[model samples]
Target: MVRVPGAKVALSTASCYPETCTTAFEMAADLGFDGVEVMVWTDPVSQDPDALRALSDRFAMPILAIHAPCLLLTQRVWTTDPWTKLQRAREAAEKLAAPTVVVHPPFRWQREYAREFVTGLARMQDESGVVFAVENMFPWRARGREVAAYLPHWDLLELDVPATTLDLSHTAVSGSDALAVCDALGDRLAHVHLADGAGSNKDEHLVPGRGSQPCAEVLERLAARGYAGCVVLEINTRRAVNRDEREADLAEGLAFARFNLAAEAAT
Candidate 1:
């Protein structure tokens, strides 16, 4: 098997969904993941840096990245203020020695936050010495209509962020070509959320090869480009019937990532 020395395949805690963050660390370690991306959400353990550090030590799994609490459901998490949430996320990443922090654009309704998001984020990154990789989001589709849910648009290319997180599932939902976006981002692409979708209005987060996305191609491209950033498995396992099922799905995702990433060297 060919290996890309700079690249590492990490497991996102969000993939564990209903499972606790502790369970995610255990699963990542059990499945031989290079590291874990801590998705800061409702899980109390996820919010506690010391607790997360304990789990990291317990499992010997490094915290590759920290995903800020920017989801709608996480509005109250960390705090109601969006900037504060990002600040806390940066702090967490720094404490855990993670190089990057994944954040989403402000919701359209948060006019004040959106107004200063670009400049604010730049300032935060400069002060913290952390890479705030802005994640691409998709427009809200309902009743056959598209709503511009995120301010400053959902497309990363349209924005002037220093670094970005290319989420393949979001690309699938937005009907954007994954390979093209990947190429366009180039070095601005500081992180990746590796998942697949079937071009549905809903974010499918399917296994890599199970969807229409060019998942393998993207991984291969990253490998060829000598991408040192983490390729995190952010697939959804909420539908898993049991712990075994979840573990199987995670294992499959890890295998897919490693295989495709190695394709570059094999050639």
Candidate 2:
């Protein structure tokens, strides 16, 4: 439980700028984030892994990247002749010296592929020295418990790993208490996906403090439980006006977080 905070903005690739990894790194570096989390697809036609690593190094931030099998990018879990794509992802993560790598659970592409995918990721973790984690899908059962029950169950099912992303907004969308989920995860949690939401079945990714979920309260809960994973905010970069807007949002989130952190310390 380290209370390590990291700001999350987007790269230029997704919707901000299509051909600007270097530009994206420059902008992300200016945002004062501890690390950059990237999501890439293993499909043959998807973005290049080499370019991703180059940008990560350019920004002087070790990578925290993800690779999920996507349909357009050949969304195959452990089957589907996905060796080429998986190898590419592995090589890229290694090259970037990324500390954490997230893989999609087998729920989306194939439910049966979960075991092999996790095992493969374990092997990748061993080979690359990266913390391999899998994100629990939206329809996971613990959504009923504000993400708590599901966190333990999800980790138990994974078996080999001991970390997760406490997506407070996703839990709220599922009609659950995000703080309670934090309690369930305890120290096994690795990071958080932060965003304020209206506590409905929506994932609009509202700016912090604008939606129903209290961002500061969530941080307080994490601190109380001695959970020190990264509190990385995720927003749609495509919708932002420019880098300045993204930075402003991050600044506000940081202020809100600092207040909660201080309160947590006092408590």
Candidate 3:
């Protein structure tokens, strides 16, 4: 096993206090994270390159990656056209000097967009220097029935995409082994959303080691595989009763990442 020397540990801006992306950067900086993953949502500053760059400078934290506005709440962000949204995300990444832009597959209802997803993604990668890391989403469960919520269903191994972002939370929700999925992904796994989840249909982004998923084991495997990627702490801290608890969670996530990716561990 070839252990990675030093995989970066970043915090996702959307991890806590969805009020503004600035809080994410501030919390990460205070917790001594290596950098941050900007999740562009309804926050106007999230979509503005100049503002994002300014925040990075102010916090002295690099923007490791940019998550495109792809969630249900961000449907009306850049433009109604999914392709346009992707293009704008790429531009933002380029301006921010972020190497990757994480995106989600279109919804099942977006037939036309889904049809061109694979090819379009490849084309975008070729045209833009930034990597378009497609994220895995969970199925929509309702009335004791399971339905494919995403265009390509949460598994990217079957897809011919160039890169992938594996989220442990999503894996747990899918009731799949985290290690098995990481093995299946191989080199295509370019980014990671470091969170844990219980075996539930709901998408719960629990902090690492707090859930049943082998979050630490997965990190060790990534190190052993010499995976050079951005590990962003993407946990949902909405349940945090106060700022102190929230800060503690973020600090724990960062420490866990550093311990697993330390140079001594790799050696």
Give the range of the ten consecutive residues with the poorest summed lDDT in model 2: 10-19
Candidate 3 has its poorest 10 consecutive residues by lDDT at 258-267
Tens-digit lDDT string for candidate 1 (1-267): 565748889999999999999999999999999999999999999999999999999999999999998999998988999998998999999999999999999999999999999999999988987899999999989899999999987999988999999999999999999999999999999999999999989998998888999999999888888888889999999999999999999999999998888544564
Q: Model 1 off-target regions past 4 Å?
A: 1-5, 263-267
Best by lDDT: 1
Question: In lDDT terms, how accurate is model 2?
Answer: 0.54
All candidates' lDDT scores? 0.93, 0.54, 0.87
Ranking of candidates on lDDT, top first: 1, 3, 2
Task: Please give the lDDT score for candidate 1.
Answer: 0.93
Clashing pairs in model 2? 43-73, 146-176, 146-177, 148-181, 197-212
Per-residue alpha-carbon lDDT of candidate 3 for residues 1-267, written as tens digits (9 for 90 to 100):
434546788999888754478888888888899899998888888889999999999999999999998888888898989999999999999998999999998888888989999998898899988999998777778778998878865677667898999998998888877889889889999999999998778888988888888888888888876778999999999988888999988889888877766433433
Checking candidate 3 for backbone clashes, the offending pairs are none
TM-score of 3: 0.95
Sort the candidates on TM-score, descending order.
Answer: 1, 3, 2
Steric clashes per prediction: 0, 5, 0
Measured over all alpha carbons after superposition, the RMSD of each candidate to the real structure, in angstroms, is 1.4, 5.7, 1.9
Q: Positional deviation of 85 in candidate 3, in angstroms?
A: 0.4
